[model samples]
Target: MSIEVSNESGMDVSEEDLISVARFAIARMNVHPAAELSMVLVDLDTMADLHVRWMDLPGPTDVMSFPMDELEPGGRPDSPMPGPAMLGDIVLCPAFAATQAKKAGHSLAHELALLTVHGVLHLLGFDHAEPDEEKEMFELQNSLLAEWLELRRQARREAQLAERDRRLLGKAGFFDA
Candidate 1:
């Protein structure tokens, strides 16, 4: 899928981080390369305004997804005839996400990654408006995020281990001797 990411509100988020998170989500979900998405990094005020307008909520949220396609007549949307569909916008508030991450006791980047996955799941027609749906959707999100974060953690661990081994070898004169 095509994930078009922009810092429209000058949020100072790294494009590298966002793209990596998108790549992880795409691989985890087995989404096709042609399925399109847009992620907008906005300020708290923009997010708060959007939240108020869209959900009738008064405060800023970490992330919100506006799914593009609605069920028409019976089946899928008209646009995605022979290819993956264009999912809609994911508006993210970095500031709010940072605050939430502090409360959640995780890195801000990690929290944002979770929110990104949540937004993408929404575009895939997953919802949590009902109790059962909420359980299913949130449990799925938690599992996916936990797996992803653990994968990253293990990879980092392996890399660090490799680096340590290399340094130990060098200190032992294995390379020089």
Candidate 2:
């Protein structure tokens, strides 16, 4: 998957993490490996403009998704043959998300990650307008985020252990080359 993230929010945000989460979400949803996604981190003013123009809302929102192609979750026995696609764009406002992060008692990075997953779901035709729809979408979104986080944690642990082993070997002159 080609996940491109552009941070134009004027705030220091982790573009790398955003891309990683997007890739994880798309892969988990069984999107084609050649599918392309774009994420933009915009400032409050830009988000506000987009919200007003697109959603007709008054203020800047946490995230907004503009899906291009109609794509359903692939890889099932009866699903369509997976192929390259333009997944669409996810616009995120870091400044607005910061307030939500404060209320949610989590780091800004975590909030962004959640929003990214939410955006991905929307791109894949998931909406939370109704109660049942909201429940299902939120459940899926939360699970995807949790699974991605756990995977990241496992990777970190493995890297830390590898580093520790390397250090120990170097100290014992076992890695001399």
Candidate 3:
């Protein structure tokens, strides 16, 4: 998957990590490997403008998804081969997210991660407009985010262990100076 993340929010957000999160979410959803996704971090002014133009809302929101080809997950046996598609764009307001993070009692990174997955799901035809849809979409989104977080934690743990082993080997004169 081609996951591109651009940061124009002027905040201290982790662009690379957000890109990884987007990639992980797309893979988990079984999107085509050639599918492309764009994630943009914008300031409050830009977000408010987008909100007014697209959603006709009054204020800046946390995240908004504008789908392109309306791609869906592909894992069914009867389904045809998954082909390349432009997934869509996810516009995130980091400034707004920070306030939401404070209210949710989590870090900005966590909030962004969740929003990224939520935006991806939306691109894949998920929505929360109705009660049932909201429940299903939110449950799936939460599960995907939790699994990705666990995977990241495992990767960090493995990296730490590998570094420890390398240091131990060096201390035991296992390498040349």
- lDDT leader: 2
* TM-score result, candidate 2: 0.94
Considering every candidate listed, which one attains the maximal TM-score? 2
Q: What TM-score would candidate 1 get against the native?
A: 0.79
Candidate 3 yields a Cα-based lDDT of 0.90
Model 1: per-residue Cα lDDT over 63-171, one tens digit each: 8998775422122435546345666788989999999999999987888888888887787778899999999889988888888878889989999999999999999
Q: How many backbone clashes does candidate 3 have?
A: 0
The residue ranges of model 1 lying beyond 4 angstroms of the native Cα positions read 69-82, 168-177
CA lDDT, candidate 1, residue 174: 95
Best first by lDDT, ranked: 2, 3, 1
Q: For each candidate in the order shown, give its overall lDDT on alpha carbons.
A: 0.79, 0.93, 0.90
TM-score per candidate, chains pooled: 0.79, 0.94, 0.93
Clashing pairs in 3: none
Q: Which residue segments of model 3 deviate by more than 4 Å? A: 75-82
Task: Indicate the residue-level lDDT of 175 in model 1.
Answer: 98
Of the candidates numbered 1 and 2, which has the greater lDDT value?
Answer: 2
Estimate the Cα RMSD of every predicted model relative to the unseen true structure: 3.9, 1.9, 2.0
